[model samples]
Target: MPTISRQGTDFIYQQVTRFISGQISSGVLQPGDRLPSLRRLSDRLSISVPTVRQAYVELERQGRVESRPQSGFYVRARARNALMKPAPCRDCKPAPVRCRSLIDRVYEGIHRPGVLPFGIANPSMAKPAAKGLNRAMKRVMARAEERSIGYAPSDGEPSLRRQIAYRYLELGGAVEPEEVIITNGGQEALSLALMAVAREGDVIAVETPTYHGALELIESLGMLALEIETCPEEGLMLSSLRSAIDRHDIKVCLFASALNNPLGSATPDEHRQELVALLEAHDIPLIEDDVYGDLRFDGTRPSPARFYSEKGLVLTVGSFSKTVAPGYRVGWLLPGRYEERVRTLKRALSCSCGLLQQMTLTEYLASGEYDRHIRALRPVLEQNAERMTGLIGRHFPGETKVSRPKGGSVLWLELPRKVDGGHLFGQALDENISICPGMLYSPSRRYRNFIRLSFGHPWSDRIEAGLETLGQLVSGH
Candidate 1:
């Protein structure tokens, strides 16, 4: 790793990215592997997070690595020359499955402009100018011009990782820069972390009714998912996890502790403590996804399970894609004991991005504007969620159940028996509304009557009208 300047926050990202990129191109690293998580890289390189983020952005732009949807950045499929080429796109699938799967249809059609999209998971910008992202991009352009165009680091910016660590520390975690590894996105971080901890055919445990992305990653890796029954309110069930651990040769526990997928539930502090204890006892590590942890509409900043577990098995994955800036493709990880493995995985995964982008992010993050923006956003999201829930209760005919989350922006809806949410997905599309049918959520067709509705977007009369139409579709009216 290159020596980083600790004076300015952004400089650290630059040094780290440079070192990593050089390592990648010079054949010092190989592909089909992982990278050090953001925290680890930062601490080791002694840089800030924005700097790390800048390097990661450059590497991503240069196509050295690719980010899997819910997985972390990995070395390009073929390392060496591949880093000089473009990585695969998010929708890049080896083989397409145009299924009669109802949930698939709904998810596919959700993004159509006219449709009320319940299948989408991200927050929408009412006007592109809401977050001043344009300003940040302009600054990046300026930096790139000032510096000679060269390869960034495989590990990303030390400074950006430091910033990530700082943010984590602020969020109530004991993290150092070395424990961080800047990633292309939260998903990439997650996928890479899981890959580091578990391998193919391993019996990895996942919370029941978990996010589809996690399940898909596990399946993609050819691992057997040991389902851990989680409570509707408390999130992951620790007792059940212990039972599963005793019965199986479990490798890793993939969980969404705060703002869990589809359910919008936050695991309690007490439960988290117990979970850490149990996992430590069993010697099983946790891959914790906290991507939505920052968007706590309920104002309760949910603490992660990593805080309680000192054994370094709690690998926390998070990203800025959800709240602050999505287009930038900035994400990070705090992998406890799996630090070296994560770093190696990241280096193999195409290295990291440019010095310019990482530098810009360093400015963006350290600018002190993030908090103000988040504060402005939180209320809007909370209100919209409430509005959608109210509409669902008042309009939908069946005994539809909803999960009231302490955090996150998505709502989980459980339709009445035999309602066939999959079928409703197609019907909703016809009404110009998209929905996340529960069939897409699990490996099995268990929650066929369930659907996930995203309320993070700007609420307008069109949204209200769309919800009304959806109600009609679900009720067969």
Candidate 2:
């Protein structure tokens, strides 16, 4: 029985919120446990009913609790088996990426008809903006008419570029429309940024278990990738980075510090600031892979790493593929000092992104539908993450550890040491389930016992069945 105090400076609802949170933290109220009725809690705490309701509403907003129709609030199943220790990256060194063949096989499984897609990381598909986007596209076509089909400028459509810049402004960062170069998607944005900054054989420092696409890009460009130790919680470890910098002839640092793939670790703003400062001090450029920056479960987007750059060495990449529509293939780059080089590369490479997609997205943003879609999408992703995590806990081996994502749509799992992730991927594929093996994520072939599963799709019985099968396989049952 927790009591509220009026003498405290905090608001009454806030105090109530803290009290309930403390109970949840201590397991005094377990997952699936019903919370006290609002009136009952009000009477117990000697507070007004409205204050209690406010506290519950706040909790609901935080994804800590849920209210049933005509019923009171109940605790959500948030039993997080968070990866407690950073994976070891002993003798970290630059090496050519060697996982392309396996990556090809994994992707093949992803497109196989009737396969349960736990391999892909496309979050927007979980609750797609199909209707909204279609509506926007129709509006764009109707408004722009023949112009929508015409070639957009090599740089990008001016209206779409302004929208991208305006979003950065909303995030407390200043980005010029001219600084925005629309690429085919985030991958192209990343490729252009990398090309603008570094060339063949340049050592690129990356988080240990990094995105496979980045590694593939490095491999394609004939660059070496040095592994940097990254925390499962906070993202890139500065100490490991500093040491790597001291030892290697590292030319560039390409990191998904905003929200790392697989691990789903979001670096705090202060950490990102330090990262930018440290890299800029060493005169090494950072290509910030921020494709998932807008998909945080809490709906609070983290500031792009470029915000803290003093030397203009931070090049940030953003995309609508993960947020709105993957096939739209709309993404932008803030190339900092390398804007001219990136623009030239963009023109030389793809000429320009799809004109219709750009016009459609610009209309989506201007009509306020983009923001509303994002707000609605975040909760679906957060709920899906919760349900998947809970099911994994219920079904997987007791020793299995999973990443508790702050946002995004994937869960990184560390299975038993003896379990081969590659073998598991093969087995899962045979069962019509596609999974991303940990080997594909690293240049040095770390995470041999790990695999990443996506909860990005709409939840269904098939997904539940797939997890159970995966659990059985992991258990050798």
Structural similarity to truth (TM-score) of each candidate: 0.75, 0.88
Please write out the lDDT profile of model 2 over residues 363-391, one tens digit for every residue.
99999999998887877787787678767
For each candidate, how many residue pairs have backbone atoms clashing (under 3 Å)? 80, 0
**Per-residue lDDT tens digits of candidate 1, residues 73-123?**
544422121101111112211121122344345556965777666678776
Displacement of residue 167 (Cα, Å) in model 2 is 0.9
- Indicate the TM-score of model 1: 0.75
Candidate 2's C-alpha lDDT? 0.89
Clashes of 2: 0
Worst 10 contiguous positions by lDDT, candidate 2: 76-85
